[model samples]
Target: MGGVLADGDRVKAVVVKSWMASTGGLEVHYQDGLEKGSSLKANAIQQGLEEDVHVSGAQDMETVVHRPAKRSKVQLGSAPPLTDSARLLARRKHCRFWENSGDEMELELLAAVGRNLQPGTDSILLGTDSHTCNAGAFGQFATGIGNTDAGFVLGTGKALLKVPTIIRFVLDGEMPPYLLDLILQIIGEISVSGATYKSMEFVGSTVESLTMEERMTLCNMVIEAGGKNGVVPADETTFKYLEGKTSIDYEPVYSDAQARFFSDYRFDVSKLEPVVAKPHSPDNRALARECKDVKIDRVYIGSCTGGKTEDFLAAAKVFLASGKKVKVPTFLVPATQKVWMDVYSLPVPGSGGKTCSQIFEEAGYDTPASPSCGACLGGPRDTYARMNEPMACVSTTNRNFPGRMGHKEGQIYLASPYTAVASALTGYVTDPRDFLM
Candidate 1:
């Protein structure tokens, strides 16, 4: 099943975000092989197992994965090395994949795919994690598939998919109390299934004004609404952001004047407020004012959606302006190690105006040793930042399903960075305006 596309199929690219060695379903196959002491070549794709050392069933099949190399500059082989990838594991380790787990996983996978992703290439991402759609932010066709399908793609380097009708959303408005709440507000208007099996493309001056990290945050959640992918066409903003980030030399892609859509919506966000999703579902959203009285036992301000520099900047600004440390147990995690350091560079007003990270550390906040999607799945008994006892939390991470944060008995309310920091300061669901100086 080499790369091929039928007429009328809308997909234009493929992204493979697997072999990271931990988390998601691939963990089983990767870890099993490690336990069996099966080593791999330093630069090999397959482990050269005689009979499926770790992968079970059809995934064990042998096939040559013909990754698209139409462009000579695209890089592959960058994902975090499995613990026992080869005899040279120590020399070729890429744990960056493991460090940035849980959300926007496709971003790191792209680095491993090649040295530079050529512009104007259509691509699909094969992975079990639904957040794989995050790649669409770069103007490529990307989405998620199951583990068996991943294995098949690994062998064949091809996949079949239904062409999804495109839906367009034009955001026209000023920044809300918090820019991060914008997408959650959009989701509240359109139920999670509203865009089922369709593409949702974001455009408008408001969207163009945002940074690349913010755009990725918007595309990353398309899967949460059951959409195939979300995209922002490559433009000057995109080009400038990607300039040095990749070595690809190809034409950029964009939407056309005659492009048709299955549906369209425009939101004038001047009236938008900070909103929160009540425990249980992403679409179960409401104005933060409605839940202002709700108390919380802890606060979480990290994830692909929350870990970006702009995100932490907003939360830090809130803390600095208010001059308050959290009243609750606030867990601060940067999406990446670089981000961990970035937080320390942004000065806060408290404790003589140290960087936000220093301010939090001085105020006794719990900073996890490493950044990973450790607690976002919370069903695992040992997930970091887990709540074993009955409690309430305000998290910026996606999903609040039963036991998502390790305690079915606990409740999670999803909010923006501003609201999350405001709640942490008060130990209650809060409106940032109420605490503003």
Candidate 2:
């Protein structure tokens, strides 16, 4: 599906199954631009196409799925149960809510829904968040759609598209020491917008070797590079990750052996090094060592990119071995509430001792009050340990763009969790190798 086409190109496409329904609401659409055709610009007062379409969006639908089986009578990691207020809203909106399911990010749940739970042909995951591309790791044609597209999708269950040029990354070695760093380095080299409106198809031995979660991490950042989506062909790892998660029968899709591409990138694990994106832009990259002189005011070690177990393992190696307390306020966040639970209760990092959460606490860090998006993408400057004063931060989040985590004035250095935890301990951007045992 990694194809490039003109802006107005159209082809015959069909929606085998329809997902969300935009039955009501303001029927909001854009007021201008490429999406002008999609926008309705309607409000309760205005008479537009919205009223003729029956108003609200995704409200009270039988087909829409709710996550975690609705009001799951379970909780974890000091996380509060689904509040009655939240339940009331979900009930009114008719949207699926994974109340107390310990999932902070909906990507996994959505992936399970689209790829496994209710597998179907010509499936697309329309999400308000940009990370909807995460589903592409399952070899699905997934991407974030603008509000205009949402209006159209709800009406017809189909979308018009400009097929993007596909860029392929072929690797032939074992995984690197810091795969997160590898992705950072690659993106830095390509620079943001290098693949604008293009697709990134990861292939080769190393990609195949990566676990589904790792592969998702690799592809999840494609959007950060200004690509349409990043995907891996369905393989053994895909099947294993989906086993028992879904019983739906569906056909898997893959690229051709001799598939053509707009460009190809080759890399060997032996030669790559850990890297970070300096302030203002993710593409402004440098090795962690190169930016060691940059002092850090705080460290953030969670996000979809950094909150996974694999990411924590790298941080744990550095944190556990150093056996020291952090000098600055460091926010330790797990991508999902389930990840929070696993870190809180389960022993990890191939070492037996305190739980991951306990270790972080002993190291003088606070678990996110709730397993929800905290301090990422410009969270409230006052709460969540967000940086208000002008300071520098070493973060494991996907972006280092101006004011990403907190105050726009704060400088953010985007790096791996390994680098972030180490920098927090040293009170500066310290190299992870200096701390890891």
Candidate 3:
């Protein structure tokens, strides 16, 4: 056989496909008459391949004889047009242990770590839910595995994966103002486990127009629906967004044309309205109009989920439109310092090019350190004030489980940044529709 296998204390192989690293460092391909369950050693395999090499435990290898491609027909236009296969390869090849002390450093760390891993290493596991897929941006079949799964992967180079069904989200028309909030509302309706063990694929023409940040935001929320993973097919748009990064040879992966979807959901972005979630659960969703009279003690507008640039832009609009200071204490922490720098530089809504940093500072809102989830995840900054304080808070973070935002007694409302900013001005949950118009 042309395939080279080397044997030592452990087994290793030189495989043509780099992504196969997850399959225990051995490449299984059709070349010559090789029987299943064949053994190869670390030194037997040929060296000097264009791609990187990997090693795995001897027990990790498996063979499925003569199985046809899992799916038959291929689906076109189902993936985002902007995927960089080469970059994904670079990220999987390199592995390192580096601490990200600050927000800017964290992003750099993530990028650097991504660049170091070789494609096809045992699937990477992450503690986070949404951003875990960012590694997928590098093409290593990465996913946000829970704590237990992560533990298992760390110990053994194998994970028991059940191929998940796919949920196709076909987006049409332009996204309305405050689109993230709207997306959250749709997600809320599905509850936390609606898509459990399923692949959430975002498709349609409108997806091409969204920025990488926007696509990431959507993909990141797959966990909210209890999905195993979310993906956007790589396209030209993906390439443009990833320009100037290290390059690797890549090919976009898509659903088979004859691929059967477990279900389909359709949305016309142009018709979406601002949405919010009631206290204690991401699924407790309602239009902001429904919660108009709820008073609040704190209004928080930042988190991994809500701390992006578009989020701040939406919040700024509402703040400027209110033409007033926030009635209650408002906490705004950027997801990372990079996001803070971006939002801080933008001029306040009505001010003649005055930046938000000046406007917020002058208005008395507290700007905490970067890379802090702060009050969003029961962090130290804002604990529940009083048992019956009747205080309401609007935030963009995911999950509203009791005691999630500091105090069990405090009432927390989940909304997009726009709604949160509007409510902060009035000290109550107010509908964003009135301000958007």
Candidate 4:
């Protein structure tokens, strides 16, 4: 079989063709045997027809699969329909320890692969989810790709990528209680296309002070700014988070002192205040306090960006400080089963043995729901806490586009957990300082 495999020019052409084919349902196209013009087309469809293995959320459990049983047509399958031998092989490759229900895809990836990621090595992580860049916080080269690239990687365990220019953002000074505002500030300044197709490397005294979860939060939103990926160099915090998660040996990588960058920007964290992105865009920024008159009917605290354990802890801290009942319908959704367990089990730091669940209940909020993407994705009309009717909401989720949480006219204000919970208590876009002070 004389065909293209490693030649750069040939590979680029093949990749482009494959991407074009993906618009019509094919994820990848590979030619075998004599690879000349018309002859190459014969085996391309057959290659894509073969089984593919993908471990995903429950939402994709009944996804359609192409199989000959229905004339090779796409039809719903309980799993990725595979031949007997393929099924056995997939079973062997599957790791049940990495499986979890009701978790966002990026969260699952971080739990399974981030801890084992080794920088300065050939280790590469790619996924179909745009937020796959969240893994870059581990100091590894990770990025999101279309299904065509994902399929290619699935088959060959390799991908062709161009080196992206780096734009470093150096954060310094005392860290604010709410870090979401920091990212919102960057996106607001750069607009949506400021860092298109480029890597945003974060490094500074403040970044070094962040927890692993906080670092992931910073990297996760890089996609919002049209960044190819975002990275935070691995440090004691990164290693500490990996301690019980993996026993893999790895070397941490850092930018050389003399490294070149496309651009460098710095910010003083102490001068910042909680910020929010108004409805319709993630970069439509405004100070959280400035929006105090923006009455809201709901508040949501969940999603890969905001539904983590630390996110819940922040909300609990706000509620503990306020000591007031919520005036609006507040919804809570943990990002994963681990987070759900933490909400029910882990004690809030200053609450003196009170769990988040207890604090939320005392604040007149409903019990936190099970782990899932929840209303952030604007699921079915029956989705829990979905804004079935047009309403203004303060949410901890990343995006706040129209109809994102459900109703077309529904408004979403993207804020930190503290702001989200505070708004829930006041029925308006209130600042956390009102309570925390």
Best by TM-score: 4
Per-candidate TM-score against the hidden true structure: 0.74, 0.75, 0.69, 0.78
Model 2 residue 246 CA deviation (Å) reads 1.8
Worst 10-residue lDDT window, candidate 4: 7-16
- Looking at candidate 1, the ten consecutive residues that score lowest on lDDT are 24-33
Write model 1 residue lDDT over 207-314, tens digit each, in one string. Answer: 877777777778878877889888877778777767676665657677789999998999887767788999888899988889978989999888767766677777
Model 3 bad stretches (over 4 Å): 1-94, 98-131, 134-141, 246-249, 346-351, 380-390
**Ranking, lDDT, top scorer first:** 4, 2, 1, 3
Candidate 1: segments with Cα more than 4 A from true spot: 1-119, 346-353
Candidate 3: tens digits of C-alpha lDDT, residues 189-264: 6778889878777788777677666665666667777877677666676666556653544555667899889988
Q: Model 1, 170: alpha-carbon shift in Å?
A: 0.6
TM-score of 3: 0.69
lDDT (Cα atoms) of all candidates against the true structure: 0.66, 0.67, 0.59, 0.74
The parts of candidate 4 lying over 4 Å away from their true place are 1-97, 101-115
What is candidate 1's CA lDDT for residue 45? 30
